[model samples]
Target: MTAVTLTADRRRGLQRRIRWIVTATIAYNVLEAVVAITAGSIASSGALIAFGLDSTIEVLSAAAVAWQFTRRDPERWEKPTLRVIAIAFFALAVYVIATSLLALIGRVEAEHSTLGIIVTAMSVVIMPFLSLAERRTGRELGSATAVADSKQTLICTCLSAAVLAGLLLNSLLGWWWADAVAGLVIAGFAVREGIEAWRGDACATSVGMILEGDDHGI
Candidate 1:
């Protein structure tokens, strides 16, 4: 095959991989949200509930990217899709911060949650592999949306670790406050990712336009 054909084939492969990655992300997050929320309700654990809500936001973010890729001209849809992802991140930050503060002030002591530990532990193992796969493909494809989605997945991994730590600490040492602290950390990461996504949209949009114009001139 010619070099052009090889490049085209590689791009197709990348697109396929991205699709699979985001679809898996959506499926896992949906399952996670349902299970985490259910477990939290049963245990009266604020942290697990907040983690579940974050998983829901992850679903939205991944869905936006999935929709973007479905378009014939995905670049045209980039800005709005990125806005959706950014808004999801901001929503996550706001909720996590507010809930963490309430949990701290109310001296909320979360009951031990065996299910929470198991689910979060599974996420901790699963998410990093998904994020890394998507990240590598995104970089090769020069797809900011895909990269942003991967970052969101990475953050979910962080949250998994946080919730796991919280559950473990509370179970082992009766340190119910650990989860609240972890929630604050999650909030900070969410805000940072949101700002980065919004800023990246502007830069990537400009670059995409330039590349498209060049192709037209060719």
Candidate 2:
């Protein structure tokens, strides 16, 4: 095959792989959200509930990315899909902030959530690498949809870390308010990312974009 043909084939392969990975991640997140919410409700852990909501929003973002990827003309749909993803993130942030504030004002204490901590720890360990890999691959392929998906993964990594920290502090230090405080941090990050994504600015200058000669990669 010619070099052009080889590059096209490689791009197709990468797209397929990214689609599979994102789909799998979304599926797992859906299950995790359900489990986390159930456990959080029983344990009365606000952090766990916020983590579950974050995962649920991630599932929506992943689905949006998948739709963008499979479109016949992704460029035409990119901006709209990204806006929708951004709105989803914004909604999640609003929910987190409201709930966290209520918990803080009421002095509601989170109960022990061993399961929540374990799941969040697992996500913290796995998600950053997945996001970085996807970001690099998306940049190489000049795929905005994939880059957006990578941002969602990065958000997941951050949320997991915050959730884990909140759970740990609450569990070990008996700082009952730590979980709600962490929820506020997560909400702040989510709102920032949501605004960026809504403005079509996510991955504005990602490493992949620099390599691909596109400043507005996502």
Candidate 3:
């Protein structure tokens, strides 16, 4: 892929844009976590609880990227920030796997949660826009951390869909197992993305690596 040469002003602008995107993502996920966790506890829906925890993990990932951008030389912080994001993904996978297993072993029946459904539905609509915007900006800026964080946001969108489906199935057809199924599905995706981020492949986005001066080599 060809590198899109960015002027100094544009680079700074993109960095600022990333900070804004992560901040917005963090804010929305915070509200989502609170509402979903509360609703999940009331409804005894493990999927909803897992969804809330995922939101918290998304917050952590976005925060890492935001912190990376705050540095005077954001590129220097890229690898560590990406690793932080990777660890967050793994943490989410472990939690969801354990929750799904416990829910299955215990034969836990998930009650319907109207709030959980609503919040997840909202996320399904909101997260994609944020992910796309950040991804485009990241690609142009050649920011690995930004791109990885965008992927993290995209994962939230998928999880929102899965959790929403599970809630609907349980509510409409008494498919209590759907909740556990959704949790397991999310865990699988999380582990895959975690491995990619840890291996630094997430930075293989089309930006062709960031450069402050004229040096550019992959």
Give the Å shift of residue 61 in candidate 3.
Answer: 0.5
How many backbone clashes does every candidate have? 0, 0, 0
Candidate 1's C-alpha runs over 4 A off are 1-6, 201-218
Q: Rate the local accuracy (lDDT) of all candidates.
A: 0.82, 0.75, 0.85
* Residue 183, model 3: Cα distance from true site in angstroms: 2.1
Q: Taking the tens digit of each residue's C-alpha lDDT, what string does model 1 give over 135-209? A: 766655667788888888888899889989989999999898898899899889889988888877523323232
CA displacement after TM-score superposition, residue 109 of candidate 3 (Å)? 0.9
Instruction: Itemize residue pairs with steric clashes in candidate 3.
Output: none
User: For each candidate, C-alpha RMSD in Å?
Assistant: 5.3, 4.7, 3.9
Off by over 4 Å in 3: 205-218
- C-alpha lDDT of residue 109 in model 3: 87
Q: Report the number of the highest-lDDT candidate.
A: 3
Q: For model 2, how does the per-residue alpha-carbon lDDT over 44-101 read when each residue is reduced to its tens digit?
A: 8776887798788888888887777787665577678878878877887888788888
TM-score of 3: 0.92
Q: For every model shown, what is its TM-score relative to the native structure? A: 0.89, 0.86, 0.92
Query: What is candidate 3's lDDT per residue for 146-214, written digit by digit as tens?
Result: 888898888789889988988898899988778677778878988999898887788665334553432
